[model samples]
Target chain A: MDSVFVHKMWNDHELSKMINQDIPFLMLSDQDGSIGKMYGIYDEDSGVETRGRFIIDPDGNIQGFEVLTPPVGRNVSETIRQIKAFQLVRESQGTEATPSGWQPGKQTLKPGPDLVGNVWKVWKVSEAFND
Target chain B: MPEEFKPGCQRPPVKKIDPETAAGISNESVLKEAKPSMVKVGKPAPDFTAAAYGQGKFVNTSLSEYKGKWVLLCFYPGDFTFV
Candidate 1:
């Protein structure tokens, strides 16, 4: 996992200490903001980056990504949830696709030629989970 | 005495840009040139190498190192700043 910050490495350490929790992931300092520029999140005027999150599959393909304004914070739990859902779908070899708000131990839909345009008839949204 | 709570007490002032300056700031065109031509879902992620702090050590790493594993790239504005 990558955590890119538009600051110096020293600031990264200081922030980590301020948070009182060790950042568990690899934290990169894009001081020149080149990475941010490449990702299309760099704000040239302010010399800062927007909050961007990308989920990549095992094959290095981007499975999903979200970009938020700098004033908005991202939801870590939601990111984890998406990772879990993506992993499950990848493990199933594309045979199954998770429905909206799907979680572990929930029913997954099997996508096939026959299941097209008839998903609602086979799977009931109310009966899928207790959420 | 209890202190009164005010919303946006610490919020920064919004920057005001003139119409002419704002119109000249075609950020989209600059971003398009900097970004990869084909950046989207199912496309290979842009690769880069940099020094990272992790596992209690500073090590040079690259996106290629995480091949064959699920990876999440989280980019934020700055350190110790409110999102």
Candidate 2:
């Protein structure tokens, strides 16, 4: 779902023809800035919404989200990484937590009371996945 | 659509109101009145229905309609603005 502060409708056919976006996604027009205000990204002074991205799970819960200033574009790869990490954790029922820079096919940590203070001891920082 | 039709050209023209009437309408007051409560992670997303242009027509859509799927709600400032 994509939301824009301005009310104008996108010419999807023209956009897809230009950008070649094969994926099907819903694009919404928050014409009155209602959704932007609800998401706390609306700038009343400028009458524009700041950049925002939210990853909502199947249950309608916001698993992860990022809000950026108007000038900065978001990282698509990072968003995909986050979604994958969240899905993995959800599949494990909260028993597993992905470490920093975790990606698919990488190792995950089994979160436990015993591992609270001994994270560094149990998981080697050198062995962690890195880009 | 005409060959000259542009993406942003479809927006409705803004209505011009009288200066005195416009002066009486405070944007700040309206903003304060329309401000929405902030949403948080781990909480339910605020539900809304909006008009979306897709597949060559305007369709009414809502957050609840995507309940059984993962949704990436991406909000941008406006159309045709460089990020």
Candidate 3:
């Protein structure tokens, strides 16, 4: 996913070095775009696969899915945040909901039928934004 | 199995898909059958043969050659960039 694409295209020496990497990462050639087609990530008009990340649960169900456009690099930190949030939800029956930009130790709101409109007030903040 | 149609034999009905309204699978059962075809988490990737150019030679490599070891399959649109 790094500059390896250039090597694949230009038939450079780095292609062999990249294929020899030890890290558990995949490098597939999508020249024909068939794999992307099966994943529904291929854009025929744009001629590129959308940057996508899917966190599949141990049971194989798609627990979280994110697709980012090329201009925006993926937020690895935010992805970890989402993973922790989902893990918390799975472990507890707490009715709390993670708010925008909510990280560890950030204030979370207890969601309920009656508290739907006032969920944001749980945080000690100055900005008043609507969801 | 004839290469060309001959005699009075009737051909099977042709199931036509209108190009104007080409769509994905509709039957849940058929989709279920298709579901297993995708690369699932923790499962072996499907076998493929592709030309790998390295060391000034382009040789065909097969997925089976990488068996018993982790493989990473990455793709990019084209080459030559600041990336």
lDDT values, one for every candidate: 0.73, 0.75, 0.51
Model 3, residue A49: what's the lDDT? 61
Query: Model 2: per-residue lDDT, tens digit, A1-131?
Result: 23432222344434565567522665688878888888888776657778889999999999888988776788898899899999999999999999987888888899878888988886677655564
DockQ of each: 0.35, 0.36, 0.06
**On residues A1-131, what C-alpha lDDT tens digit does candidate 3 reach at each position?**
22334444554444435656432333445566665565555555556665656554433344565655544556677677777776665556567766666677666667778776775556645322332
Model 1 chain B lDDT-worst window of ten: B5-14
Q: Pick the candidate with the highest lDDT.
A: 2
Model 3 ranges with Cα > 4 A deviation: A1-21, A26-32, A124-131, B1-83
- Model 2 steric clash pairs: none
Using DockQ as the yardstick, the better of models 1 and 2 is 2
Ignoring the other chain, what TM-score does chain B have in each prediction? 0.52, 0.55, 0.49
Winner on TM-score (1 vs 3): 1
Could you tell me every candidate's TM-score relative to the true structure?
0.73, 0.75, 0.46
Please give, for residues B1-83, the per-residue lDDT of candidate 3 as tens digits.
74565422123233566443466545543423233133454343445665554444445676667654433343333443211
